[model samples]
Target: MVSVSASLAIAATLPARAEDPPPQLTGDWGGWRTELANRGIEFQIGYTEEAAGNASGGQHNYVRAAGQLVLGSTLDLQKLFGVSGATMQITLTNRNGRNLSDDAGLNTLQQVQEVYGRGNIWRLTQFWYEQKAFDGAVALKFGRVTLGEDFAAFSCNFQNLTFCGSTPGNLAGNYWFNWPLSQWGARLKVKSGQVYVQAGAYQVSPRNSDPDRGFYLGWEQTSGALLPVEFGWTPTVGGLPGKYTATLWYDTSHANDVLRNRQGLPLAVYGGDPRREQGRYGVSFQFQQQLTRPDVADPVRGLSAFLNITQTDRRTSQTDNQIAFGLFYTGWLDSRPRDVMAIAIGRTQVNGRYAENQALANFNARGFLQRPEAEYAIEAYYNLNLHSGLDIRPNIQFIRHPGGITNAKDVLVLGVKAIVNL
Candidate 1:
């Protein structure tokens, strides 16, 4: 997650120079970008490309590329029309490409590329209106929104999905969709000096992910509501800042039991009768801290670490729990202030009930077998900032167990990601 204070510090160091042009691929539209910002309308456009392949240990070796285009705009009500404390944001996204996970037959739970999702489709990602009141202590937002954008907001500096976005959303994807797939939702937040509380209610519907229904806003087949609450603390340690957040989410929807039958026995052994349950829930904790302060000459360079953990109801979740931690260093070399290096490790634990079911199925179908358990992944990358608006990251990942299945061999993956601001 990017801290507000850290963003401010970076901005403070980049004072505009009359002689230098704006740092954008489009060259600030010949100063039009600044003119529009002054008038309260800010537009943004970007594209990201990821190419990945499994070099060893998967079912097959294949290379694939995924691409995403994002277009967005933000309008400030106060500056545009003299309306106080209100703003509106709109974003559109398009994704195209084949997924490496499926292509290589490496059943890794977390995706290899953060940009690969519901591929080859266009969708309205975000359209929200926010208003602030009570001297900016309270805020309210509503409309098509993704819960991850506000709560448990994690950075996407790494290529792996495990280290990107909200942990709960990554673990409980069936119910909690992350970015590029939003639903009707609203959020309210209240903040004080160093602490804050926030809550949200969102529509839960699987149909929202269907590309054919990309623009569908109807409540048809709506299962139930997804409600979330979070509390956060921001503190300064040794003059450096940190943020800690805890979140709880409950989906008041009917969920099918993963392993149980109507008689509460293993579904595979009980005539394949499925059992259904109401409500699904999860919890997550996230922490990001600046470990080393940057020197006065390079306010944008520093060392930071992050940890995220999430647990979901085992009976209803495919992956019951996930934990990830990582460290990142910016500007390790004074000459390359825009460069960053990071390493992260993540583990996804299979649900015990699901494992038992798999074991039973294997025994019945194959006569002898091992059950699924957990998968572990570790990744490291160096982000080379080619320019203010361009970045290229080369990364590698090792997977101890590709699919949580005991027989699955370890896998090694190599990839590169490129992001451009247009």
Candidate 2:
């Protein structure tokens, strides 16, 4: 799908370079002299597979593959009129999930059932348009954009084994929650000097195809020392840090209610028939800092740390109330060149008493989701600039449900991974 908005084209007339014109004077636009064209395209493909053996919980096997294509036409930096840039993107994915009653790779496979919407394939994950930023500073965007969907975690699933769920219980998460999140709205971006902000809203109609009004609001900013946002595309405890700065953000979501009947009786949850309305409301926060000691001219001398906290409550009888906490850090063994190491640890707790689908959320690197019950993860990754498309990562992940708690032998997962970024 392509969306085009035409406006005033850039002006094309220039005087001599004598001393410079007024500061507020807009630059020249048009003509072959200052025209800019992007005419660039890119594509990425990923595939992964995993299987378990032995007496742990039921053996599990999974496979996921995705591909993305992006197209962008060039634009003139000097032209000020009739939209200067245009971009379109497309994605597709297929994931197979199942738990085996016996050993998966050991011998013959027995009973294995698909989990949730496992067999379902998303032929098109995303389709959107991106304009040349209004200014080199504010990147105004709109359309059906993915929300805190947890994509980062989806990427590290197999290709790289070191990192656990960046968006654990999110839509693309492994254990419980699974769903590609989307928002229909407008987003504005502005930046000046070393400071910038991203804020946007999503509209939700009560029914699936109905026209209910819903909104998504988020704000993030960065300075010489701080980088903070209400909700990032990916969920993580690793906040952006600076030698001397602070970053912070807050956000909220309310789903549209299309379940009210004409007499105000509850009917269906998503359609616009005489229905009752309900929605999901939640907020999130993040903080980061770079610890420096005395006279250190370089940022390599300081350690950085951050924390994230979030909560959700839906006015439905199904599932409600969720909380999560995460901590992360980036500190070098010493102040020597680009030698850096990072660690991220996280814990997620859902209302264990509920029998609803609350335990289905997941957390992935792309964003934060509820994830499985009693889930904790610890990971370490080291950057290897010399080893092209490679990273050294070691990680430990624990997962379990109410059933796995009493057995003591619970669920334990450990692995080492290498990343090849093509």
Residue pairs in clash, model 1: none
lDDT (C-alpha, whole model) for all candidates: 0.80, 0.31
Global fold similarity of model 1 (TM-score):
0.94
Please, what are the lDDT tens digits per residue for candidate 2 over residues 1-422?
Answer: 11011000000000111111111112223432223322233332332233322234334443222222222222222343444654554444443433332223211111111121223333333445556554556565566554332111122222112122223223112112222323344555566655555665544322212112112222222101111133232222233232111223122322332233446543432223443333334344434344443325543334444444433333321222222332222234443333334555544443343222222222222344332233333444443322322233443334333221223333333433332323
Q: Give the alpha carbon lDDT tens digit for every residue of 206-275 in model 1.
A: 8888866667677888999999999999888786777899999999999989999878888867756678
Q: Which candidate number maximizes TM-score?
A: 1
Q: Worst ten-residue run, lDDT, model 1? A: 11-20
